[model samples]
Target: MRRNWTDTVVAMLVATALGGCATSKDKVLPHGDHTMLDVWNQETGGSAGGGQPARQLLDARQGLRRPLIEADVQAAPANNAAYTRTAANEIYRQFHRLPNPDLVMYVLPHLAGTDPVPVPGYTTVFPLYQRVQYAMPGERLEDY
Candidate 1:
């Protein structure tokens, strides 16, 4: 039987309304007298709950985070070789942009419409190629 879409939607709406009106107010979770703050305080050792105090926990964490010094930075050369390069070296390593030589054009002086007012000639520059090109990583990109 081909049921009208409007009738199907109305039936679904009625079913949903009836489901929402059901007298099922049963508790799904066990009763708890504590607020979320109370649980958080207990876990994080806040003043209201018993645990490691927040200050002492922070101190312990801070102690583990040893600050990096010049000597420390120099010590990990082998492990951090790839990461240690200056940003300029990193960008030009693989996908260096092929040089886009500029094309300089000189527009000759011309007369304007209706009134023969002379327009001054001007020089303009454009890139030789339509779009920028990139050299493949590790490819020889020098002038051949």
Candidate 2:
């Protein structure tokens, strides 16, 4: 009898606690005829999103933007302090890739499979090195 009383009290307490957690739907979610843009603006706290302001924004940005002239193009290379005009910076500089020797393998035609079909012989070429190596700056490479 005592156990039943305690269980009933505990169940009532739990039920009361759960019942308190039930919030009015109005309080839990926003209630109004609000557009998606209005909700987005409220959440992000940024200027409103729309195409109407794009033209004004673009026109305002145009105030700061200016077209590049020949003077601007000619001055760029001169202002660079780390590097001067060199063959390496121009067409004179060449990317000389390290040479990789070719391995020519000739497959001799022979009978294959249980049916003994004649397989025609063919020649295939492969690189001797697994990966093409690169020459370090100023590294000497001998001509083959």
Candidate 3:
């Protein structure tokens, strides 16, 4: 069979052009034509009989904590009073502004078998939304 040099050259050029389109800053790329449920199932943590794999859980928690720790270090409050004062001022400003709030405070009681459980393994406090989404009612969250 005769080799098609023109077709080969065209293919190489197209490949190079496509490669150039991909930037170094791409942390994640779209998974083309996959439904949300399909992606969820693919990423579901595999059950290991009684519970999840300890190592995998620890890794996930550590991964989550890394960015938060970095942010905390960068935000380095001079003291507890300074941190509290800053947070309180932000909360007051939001309160003054009504619906648009700096923080959404939620208190959820940990329960085990229908009773409020103690912290030593029965239940623990899970703080959600330290990063507040400030938005008016009926407004899209992504708008802000």
Query: Scored by CA lDDT, what does every candidate get?
Result: 0.80, 0.76, 0.54
Query: Which model scores highest in TM-score?
Result: 1
lDDT per residue as tens, model 3, 20-78: 77756444564568777655544554332323455576688888873457667766765
State the lDDT at 86 in candidate 1: 79
Pitting candidate 1 against candidate 2, the one with the higher lDDT is 1
Candidate 2 per-residue lDDT, tens place, 113-135, comes to: 99999999999999999986767
Which residue pairs does candidate 2 place in steric collision?
none
- Given candidate 1, what's the lDDT at residue 80? 83
TM-score of candidate 1 on Cα atoms, chains taken together: 0.36
RMSD, candidate 3, Å: 28.9
User: By TM-score, is 1 or 2 better?
Assistant: 1
Candidate 3 lands at a TM-score of 0.19
- What alpha-carbon RMSD in Å does predicted model 1 have with respect to the real structure? 12.1
lDDT of 3: 0.54
Segments in model 3 whose C-alpha atoms lie over 4 Å from true places: 1-52, 67-74, 78-94, 97-144
lDDT for position 25 in model 1: 57
**Candidate 1 residue spans exceeding 4 A from truth:** 1-16, 23-31, 52-59, 65-105, 118-144
Question: Which digits, one per residue and each the tens of the lDDT, describe model 1 over residues 60-106?
Answer: 88989978998888878766876566787666556768888999999
